[model samples]
Target chain A: MMKTKTKIPEYTSPLIEQIYEGISQNTFDFVANRMQLALRISEAIKAKNWSQKQFAEMMGKRPSEVSRWLSGTHNFTTDTLWHIEQVLDIRLLAETNQESTPIFEADRLRKFVLQEVNNALEKYLSSRKLVSA
Target chain B: MKFKIVKLSRFSGNKSSLYSVIIDGEQETLFDTFIRNNVSENLHEVEQIFATLNSIGKKVGANDIFFRKKKEGKAGDGVEAIYDYPSAKLRLYCIRYGSVTLVLGDGGEKKVRAWQDDEQLSKAANEMIKISQILTQAIRDGDLSWDGNDFVGQFEFNDNDEDED
Candidate 1:
């Protein structure tokens, strides 16, 4: 039954085109974030050498519920994510403001550099105006 | 019943190949049918599922955690399901060949708790399982062969299920 390579049909249609582009960007972002959270939870569980069921017990959720949560479509609340972080001791969300974290200092430094650059540009513009005068 | 295994171009990427089945006499693929039926009531769930599919097809590899993993996977024939979990409003069944290839099948609102409880959902899942078996047999018999990204020796599937198109 082996024959020469045949072309597989590309199943693109108008409806598919509409659906692919029709969905809102917000929906896509929500899905991507959910997937990332699910992956992070799975990874944390794996790193701890614990099965999903064990992780579920630690999180005080049913194994079935945990499985559903990892299906990449869960509308996770901030409370649930925080709980997961506590149970797994894994950081899923970045700190908005934490003085001890290196990111905070780096962000501060970046802001200072931007302000300095703006001041230097203002001085250069004033000098140029005076020279033209 | 007869169907054609068609690869979806928009979702296909370097990471994985997304496929769909077009029943004989149908104008669009099974995945299209799922989207058309649920566009009005379950638009958000539909969009989320589409986003997940697009991600799996492009950026992220088709990891098992992203899906129900195996509604019929105990058979070990790649029969799986995908949906925006917790909502469980709609479920799309498919056949996965490892993480590289997937054949999207049509789905219906899983109003009941189990697919077996709802006749329509059962039919959708079962149809994909039948397709999975047929495709596996075709590869074994040399009617279809792996051509890198997808099976390319033949697109035709002479499945004998008495299901409606």
Candidate 2:
């Protein structure tokens, strides 16, 4: 039998390699979240049948400014985000109940992990008893 | 590799927000050189700039105000990446060939307050201009094609044009 070899393409630049190497998971998340926000804004405008110009007018900004905003690199401030939410009448970021939602979620996750661990331990003990018997 | 235009950002008004030339050749790209010399040196300010550029590359249409026109002219003018840090004065220069094509040039830490005062940046700008001229000629001679958005060509030093500087 003959083995076929696969050739791997090398990147042309060390700069590109360094840049790629420098990018962390946090940077990926940050870039992804920004893109998601841009997509959401565009989708909301499309759903309302609003053109870029119309959306700009609604937002009280120029079409060019709105265009930049939707370009996926706008460092959106919290105030600007709130304004966009108000004008678009859609929640862009996920809103959670202020009270005990996060705490409840953490508690639930802990309980689920604990349950799984107990189940695994029980299975191990039952197998040991069987082996001894 | 050849000269390919990667739209760093969407079109705004007469031109796209940013365009970085993807120059891949048998030899290393100018971008590659720029990254290697500066990135490995590990200067804090320069690292931030590269990191920002990396983040921008990751995002769709990652154009921001940090990229500004080095010269006040039409689409095919000089452009530079304005270092975003308030205290840092480094400029990454390039050449904008069309509505959305930029050839990356060498960049350096800004020494003088005025861009003109900085000899390094001026030299970088000159190099970019020369590449832009070569690209323009290549396109005119049918060696390169501008398809309304990007300049498509086989950018080899050995191949088409004889007018090498």
Candidate 3:
């Protein structure tokens, strides 16, 4: 019997290029961290089969407020983070054993920076070539 | 669909990097124009969208921001070039048709409530629907022709055309 393969959705975005061009690594980490938290919360809510309304009720907040919170933009404060963890019974923040945050790891950040710089330089060279051509 | 990218610097005061679709020869660029205007809170979102499109034009043939499936009926079942930033609460809508033409529509911050609760977004959705219908019909009626990847021939839209009625 042959195994049927599930297709993995490609998450490429044109904005990634712009992000590389305009944003700093710290900014990237900040946005990515927030998105990660939002995803986790969203997944946990889905796993519990709860609607935003239900979750809002549990959190003693309005549905509209919860909707914004889960919209992947809400900057979670420490208190709110703790409160959510308490309510969801899930940890929203990672507690790494490393001395520094894993996101700021020297090697990984260096690789990402190099890749972005190379992409920009490559684009610049190509455009210059087109202009001269 | 497919399209020959038409650079829009000649017809506008905006950056040369911006692109729209040429159906036959008419520029179907309402979306690009809206981005040029860049109203209110969407200023940042529109700028980001513009840059994203320029980047996509250079590197990938089409990427997520260039072609995205939108909510059927809500967006008239058209493809959208989303400028989705949760922090900004913004989305810009677009529609591509006949493999060679794309038109843009206005979009703004998504209401926390729902789209139906907001009049502007609803209007934008209606605009997407209207453009989609017009472009598709034009292709079906042989008023527009595309060679899978590029547009060919000439097109003119008459205000009093029977299609409008």
Name the best candidate (by lDDT).
Answer: 1
What tens digits encode model 3's per-residue C-alpha lDDT throughout A25-117?
444455445544665787788888988689889999998677667644476788888888998889876675758766668789899789778
Q: Pick the candidate with the highest TM-score.
A: 1
How much of the real interface does each model capture, measured as fnat?
A: 0.61, 0.09, 0.01
Measured on C-alpha atoms, candidate 2 has an lDDT of 0.54
TM-score of chain B of 3: 0.64
Model 2: docking quality category: incorrect
Report the lDDT tens digits of candidate 2 across residue range B1-165: 134434433122133333445454525545545544554333444445544444444443333333565341235644455424345555677654432444556676666766666776676666566556655665677766656544444434222325352
Residue-wise lDDT of candidate 2 within A21-80, one digit each (tens)?
A: 444444446555765587688878889999989999988899878766775557888888
* Model 3 C-alpha lDDT per residue in residues B22-96, reported as the tens digit of each score: 333434444543443443334335445544444333322232223445452444466464434556566666665
User: Candidate 1 residues B1-165, lDDT tens each?
Assistant: 688888889988876799999888998888988877776566657666778887788766577877666454356756788745664588888887777788899888978877777887888888887888888887787777766677678777665632423
Tens-place lDDT per residue, model 1, A20-127, is 666556556767777777777888889999999998899888998898887676777888888998988988777768558689889999986786576546535543
Q: Which regions of candidate 2 are displaced past 4 Å?
A: A1-10, A31-75, A87-91, A98-133, B1-27, B40-59, B62-66, B70-75, B78-88, B95-102, B146-152, B157-165
Give each prediction's root-mean-square deviation over alpha carbons.
12.4, 13.7, 12.2
| Segments in model 3 whose C-alpha atoms lie over 4 Å from true places | A1-29, A96-133, B1-31, B39-43, B47-91, B94-105, B108-124, B131-165
Candidate 3 clashing pairs, residues 3+ apart or interchain: B1-B99, B2-B99, B2-B100, B31-B104
Per prediction, the TM-score for chain B is 0.89, 0.59, 0.64
